[model samples]
Target: MRAAVFVFKRFCGSSFRLQNRGVCDVAVVGGGIVGLSSARELIIRHPNLSFTLLEKENELALHQSGHNSGVIHSGIYYTPGSLKAQLCVKGASLAYKYCDDKGIPYKRCGKLIVAVEREEISRLKALYERGLQNNVKDLSLIDARGIREREPYCRGIMALDSPYTGIVDWCLVALTYAKDFQNAGGSIVTGFEASDISMATESPAGEPEGLKYPVIIRNTKGEEVRCRYVLTCGGLYSDRLSAISGCSTEPRIVPFRGDYLVLKPEKSYLIKGNIYPVPDPRFPFLGVHFTPRIDGSVWLGPNAVLAFKREGYNLFDFNAKDFTDALLFRGLQKLVLKNLLYGISEMYRGVFLGAQVKILQKYIPELGRSDIMRGPSGVRAQALDSGGNLVDDFVFDGGVGELGGRVLHVRNAPSPAATSSLAIAEMIADELEVRFNL
Candidate 1:
């Protein structure tokens, strides 16, 4: 085997065909923030081992990582002992530090989970207690006057103020991880859509490396990376990747599109920082909320609705296979039936601008339908179990038999995945050390 012949062009928008590429000790299968972070960490921790990052697209972070609300979540809403809760609190701190060390700019713009109704105060209290249990920094239970002090036009009987909840260009953060991975001598290969992962029984001809690159990682275009170990952080396609590797896809990836309405620039200043509603415990998603991006523009209302396509952004965007998969899935079917009214309400809000503004006005009475217009949208890859439960935690798998020891699949990383990425990478590094005997 030869050393990898790939060269870099600043780690994004660059594609290299794997022509006679050398076998790497590890091949990371995803180019999003988490995959990049893990690859960077793995390579940095084991510099003697060669590594490569394989991205399906021609660029990185072009999906979930790029199209998010860019909020560095403060770990307020997750179950107290869950991976999301643990990693998000620690990841937020690490994200801030990483930005500091990388000179990447971010804003600790803060967030307020406002309880508009008297009955909602109990849920708000629970949320506050959960934040405390999770060690979210500087969480405070503020009254109506305190909410007014923080967001002048906002209205709430009570609110949980997360002073350290911040915003950043996650795409920038992901790119920085790509840079770090490359800087640490890890090769980045774009346009390498991973189609399969299988362990080898014997070495390939002429290599004579004694099964050194035994793990066969293939792409749809017939290209492959023969590596010693594989790590998949596939976001939307995680289940497919896992299934092909002989793992159960019981918790399948279901795409849900969230559509946002941006506040008119003149009205952007009505509220400061993020303003969220008291979430209903029945729902997996945090209901529609106001999010101020790092770019100074304020956005309101990201109503979650069923997406017809995994990569769909528009109301009518459709992929037959994606639609069929969602429609046939028993978990999604049961989920929709259970939350029928809630799903209808989300869909209604997504369709009618006035309906969405009405909800937004709950917090800021000053807002109206005319004060906002459609904004950018993103597809959330939610994982669902066969029994119709939303899998609301981190799920990792490595299949069975020979490949079990050679690959790891991040099957599901719920909301706050972006906030938890760096910390999640540290956990992945620990897993690799013990699982792969690194």
Candidate 2:
């Protein structure tokens, strides 16, 4: 065990190469797509500035960015004037351009929002209008025949077609971003878990107080790095990391596990593109849907259930602290009470394969329990407010108190986050440039 521990420490130490006197212009916490993109954007905009990116895991995109459904959303479901709608619409184009420039493979396969029942058609129409309002191009409301033309096996009274929707391997995209950041002279240090952030008072002689490096970040290994500014894109632990930097904790992260079912090889042909249901507006989570991955397999489901741990991917995975945090939160309690039926139904589908197949059969009448095998799962970092309302849009909170004007935190960025990563990075960079005169 001692030998193993020694080897582990040596390996991690080699990756970081931390210097006792090392400093940077910026330190980005979190190595997900957003962090990588942010780092890339910073280096591109300010060619001479230095940056350090910290990640707890040895590799990047092992969490939400890796586990997502890989759907390039077309700005359909978000509120018209919200950040999600704006960023997602812009991000889709940016993502495609990035993919083309990087030679990353992607497809503009289009998507169908199917309304199987009469009640859903009205809601579907409302969504179509919302999409139009959000400036989603090539969006059209279609009848049953139109749905047939788009997705032959999909059963629906009506549907909305988004031709701009597409798919790409997001993990690959994130890796490419990491490579670009490194190529631009930004340092990426994995296995460095940022434990606390404090203000650094020391400044170089004759430096203005406002220009001094004010943020000190300490990792679990007791290593310290000082920076003039900090941007945290911590996905699952955003709240904790923000609070460590003297930011408000009114909205806390709650982990929700979304499990998918991969169709059998023969059954993969059932979905040509993406098929989705009209989502409940009260919550941000889109309902169970059919997604065709770039790898030529169809994925169904992603039923949302409270996860016992932030990174829990298996059914029985548990963590006492994570479980207790969700259970004891007043916001979770209120959210559960308000959406009791929906929550119970989602949990049911999570547990029973038949229940999930039933939901999928609403769109693909041919799907049976035997047609699918258990596939991968991802945990969403859902943010809930103290008042029990689930945050429904992209949320960014700049630090306050001691860390004021020096730190920025992304409190909630789920679903379309991977798609909006580059555009989101641009927004963060713009904010930092204006605030710090970068």
Of the candidates shown, which would achieve the greatest TM-score relative to the real structure?
Answer: 1
Q: What's the CA error at residue 402 for candidate 2, in Å?
A: 3.9
Model 2: lDDT of residue 136? 95
lDDT, candidate 2, at 270: 80
Give me the runs in candidate 1 sitting further than 4 Å from their true place: 1-20
In candidate 1, what are the lDDT values of residues 1-438, reduced to their tens digit?
A: 333343434343543333335478888999888898899889889999999889888678889998899999989888889888999999999999999998888999899999999999999999999989999899999999999999999998999999999999998899888878887777888777888888876788887658768898878878778888889999998999899999996789999999988988998889789899999888767888999988889888798999999999998999999999999999999999999999999998888889988888899999888889899999999999978899888999987998889989999977788988999999999998899998
Model 1 lDDT-worst window of ten:
10-19
RMSD of each: 2.4, 4.1
lDDT value, candidate 2, whole model: 0.85
Runs with alpha carbons beyond 4 Å of true place in candidate 2: 1-21, 201-212, 282-284
lDDT of 2 by residue, 23-81 (tens): 68899999899998999999999989889888888777779988899989999888899
Query: lDDT scores for all predictions?
Result: 0.87, 0.85
TM-score of each: 0.95, 0.92
Q: Give the TM-score of candidate 1.
A: 0.95
